[model samples]
Target: MSDQTTQRHPNILFILADNLGYGELGVYGGGPLRGAPTPHIDGLAAEGLRLTNMNMEPQCTPSRSSMLTGRHAIRSGTYAVPLGGVPEGLTQWEITLPKLLSDAGYATALYGKWHLGRDDGRLPNDQGFDEWYGIPRTTHETTWLTSPGYAPELVRPQHIMEGRKGEPSRELQVYDMQERRVIDAEITRRTVAFMEERARGHQPFYLFTSLTQPHFPTLPHPRFAGSTGKGDWADMLAEMDHNVGEMLAAIDRLGLRENTIVIFTSDNGAEFIKPWEGWAGPWRGAYFTALEGGLRVPFILRWPGQVPPGLTSDELVHGVDLFTTLATIAGVAIPQDRPIDGVNQCDLFQGTSAKSGRDGLLVWVDNRLQAVKWRNFKAHFYQQDTMMSPPEKLPVPFIIDLYTNPREEEGKRASGWVLEPMLKMVQAFEASLVEHPAIPMGTPDPYEPPRRCP
Candidate 1:
């Protein structure tokens, strides 16, 4: 690792959208065609690199945990979203990205939805952030207060929370539909303020501005409710575009554009809910499934002079790869005690290399090995049509050439040889579990990895 004092580490502004799909932004394919224009986000891509084949976990909790820990969500006990008050999230033992950056002398703050945990020891501040403000769980709870036959004692109303490190989170207000409409704007405002303050102090900061937009029950701010005139969904898209523009403008205004790395991506593919559901462009299925639509999402990164502008790559990069990639960029050492699934992709991001460090990644949905994506080929051990349907366990691995079947539909068969590499990747991963067993879902705190034999 480089000396922190000698090398001024670049600031990281990671803006994550909830349930945003690959085709949602204009650069990849949708924007105006989807009835809302994303000029601001598109401009960001025009000034940076746009990744077409970026893959994430099938759901929010899994993807987020994977990225932060640089390990598979299954290894960290967060393979799926916690439901029915299940206490599922990252254990205290996991080494998160924000924690690493903080140790490297970077100030950290998280604004927006944090689906990682709802308990004291599992929250953002507890993990690594210096200060944080966001919902402790998913936005789906915002509707719980209004649902028919709702009972407060059964499931308490979700609240907007704020906290600093070493302090309990302060519950602000009930996060209802009205509050949901305005919360994103607040996140952006606080993020901009944090950027300004850190820039003034001449400190490198890692700002995880996680936005809760275009998720289920998608609603735009009151001011933008009807701005698009296409519908509420389009209106929400327009609002998100404007908010992202504000953040970009702030970086430029603070004169931090040249030194800050601005990233825009999502935790999942798209919403599986109806009416408020999002478009995955050309892919099939939705969030919570093993299909391409569930695994692929939009990813854009901008770093003036350092990262080449207006370049696009189809290189396969997993969401967990960001951990090692950013840690390398920030001059931090990745922990060697655990199996880190993320590989360094700094060269790929800087345009010096056309190939990603990883050629394949195992796809886990609900703690089960559902699929394996090796280069442009994919082999599925389980098949799921949508989030609402039951998964079918196949006796034989089903193979598809993603180049010809981006939709993963029946057509353009892949050679049987593709299975050999896929099998090798899966076998190596399973063998690793023998030494470092995966933490079971809902594992309590004060957790420790099982002892490895010499």
Candidate 2:
């Protein structure tokens, strides 16, 4: 971060969580009910914006890929979670948010959880970041690295790599479930160091600090363990909140509070794993389904003096919009060379307009477009009640008013009310594909040196 008087671009601090519920945050409706009171995360909503209708894809890799590139995961070759992260990710040609920022003279780094392929050409640093230190894939895949009592220790280790430009991505440690307990804190400390380094330098920084918690194997750090009476998941949320407060405080300490844009969001909705599943609040279904509970998430943005405080909007915003929005805020240009799915919602964020000015967002499960939502009505092409289960197809997409069936109990067949708008959205999506032509499926590249993957 730099002095406002001399700074050209605002620093971007994007915080993301794994399997965090929409109702898990105080603003979204979790907090004490979920056994974790998130004052710090709630504070972001209080002082900034909380998007009630913000949407993400139903799974992690797709949601994350869409967020970064502002392109559908199918187009980016990450529509589904890979077998230990294969088939490469996003391709070497795709332009990312960090890549844009880095090109525009801002320092870019990513700390924690990069599931976007770990091969030589697809890691965080390879994409656009200047420095990257984090897990290369999902947390569940590393359960074996955990201790016997804590998490199932693996025969093979998941490397926590430290990557920088011109140097090889170095393996710093093999993270276990025990490491997951305090990994957020470790990431926070590293992020604060990044901020400190940038504060003394001329270049502003963008740190995408993704936390690996509230996901499976949610082992909370010692202090936060059982802080929430509910269970390990609740305790993990509380710990994450504390780490968030620490990160925010560090920005203020560096006098970069007003010059930075802090965004807190999740990759997707709550996990569906029982005995460790998250509460989706009043909604039905969790990750890997076409339910609102799986796609909708908490999106909070705080930028002092730039974005107004205490503003809550239920306007339509999608995960893919991050790329264009961040680029606009940073005074950078969106890649005119490609068709980016993100819309520049700078006006909505600045509170200049009440509407998000978005047409709609598609609902996908892996490569299949399961549903399409426009306004309050949604048309479901497939009926899926659980993750990894076969979806039932309908003769016509089942259209439902999300308000009436918040739990996704059932839906009426499409009529003019739902069919008309849904058709438009579907046609638009089809046109976009016809115009740009996507490289839909590709096989995984061979695993690189230093480590082997299944």
Candidate 3:
């Protein structure tokens, strides 16, 4: 190999949790949930960098889209869960993170839940992933393990399939909705197999291990079922942590640990209802709304020599920022024509910079503008008076101070933070809304509303 090729390009192991909170893990002071500890995850944090101000979309699909596209979820055409795939889907025009890295000679594979799109063309394969396994959509109907055989009532529609280069696609109903377990061992085994395969190859790889764990209808394997002191939720979390430990162990066994960059974060905050007795730390509320508990999540990144170990950073960061950061680390050029919301913050992770490249970030839920994070201030807006109300009232918009309000623990009282700058930013965003209207509320219509969901 040439000198350039001999200089190892960092491998990426990105793990995303479904609904995790900032305070749930040991490193984050989550405390023992029923006596079980996230030692693996905490160890990773202790040996890597822990981001204290990491933010994400309030829901799963949007956040997933943001992570892949490096753009705000609104730009991805997935404002909310599409009932009939209306307003088009995540357009092919956008270059995804995996696709970008793949183009630059990285082998990309996405394992576990891919809730971004359901159509094959819109699936991970079409979006630059070299290999894909797991559910393509977020529906309670499909089980991850025993699908197509044990037909059970599905709570929603989901696509479960596996694909590789030049291989005929295999569709299976492996998921068991009622049981709430995706045959844990199978998923872990496949992941291990992938890791082993990649270890034998010379090419750098980007593997997105998107586990469907700690989500609703929580189910931990028999071994982990009463392991945690918190209950089933804690048990499920412990199981998820165990899977992570397995993956990390594979990296060590394959001697890929030093050269690989392992990033662990959640898609969003915990759900409204705690699934496995999971706590959002001090944050209040759960998924589906613009609350601290809904967006602020635990973020840990480990790259032996590249990232400083055992460092904690409170600088603001977002899931969208991962694309540019990875691109910068890989020394790849990002296209300048399209708007990329993410900024390369590798320095921030290294503990050399306290400044966040972003001045502000707009948070969207179900395609509607729900919150804005400007510096230390975060303004959370709601459409209707109710927490889960429709997007109509959101058009008016409002503001809140996240640092002072934190998780809205104070109830209706304001944190006394000024709203002028936030209002200005919201106005600018609203003006931009002219070009990209919110997905119309209510049922389907020939005449769509001016505002669209993000």
TM-score against truth, every candidate: 0.97, 0.93, 0.86
Error of 2 at 280 (Å): 1.6
Q: Where does model 2 exceed 4 Å of error? A: 1-6, 84-86, 145-155, 411-414, 443-454
Candidate ranking under TM-score, highest first, comes to 1, 2, 3
Writing each residue's lDDT as its tens digit, candidate 3 over 1-454 gives 2325524568899998877766778778764743468889999999899888888887787888788878777765665655553533466666788888888888889888887666555677877888888877653444433555443364344546788744544676645564346444556777788878877765678899888876766677777877765677777778888888998999899888888899999988875553343567877766777777777899999999888888888888988899899888887888785567788898888777878777777777776677777877766566432235554554434555666666554354444354677678778766756765543322222333355467
Tell me the deviation in Å of residue 50 in model 1: 0.3
Model 3 scores a C-alpha lDDT of: 0.73
What TM-score would candidate 3 get against the native? 0.86
Compared with the true structure, all predictions reach lDDT values of: 0.90, 0.82, 0.73
Descending-lDDT candidate ranking:
1, 2, 3
Model 3 deviation from the true structure expressed as Cα RMSD, one decimal place: 5.0
Which of 1 and 2 is ahead in lDDT?
1
lDDT of 2 by residue, 73-109 (tens): 8776689887653365667777898888888888999
Best by lDDT: 1
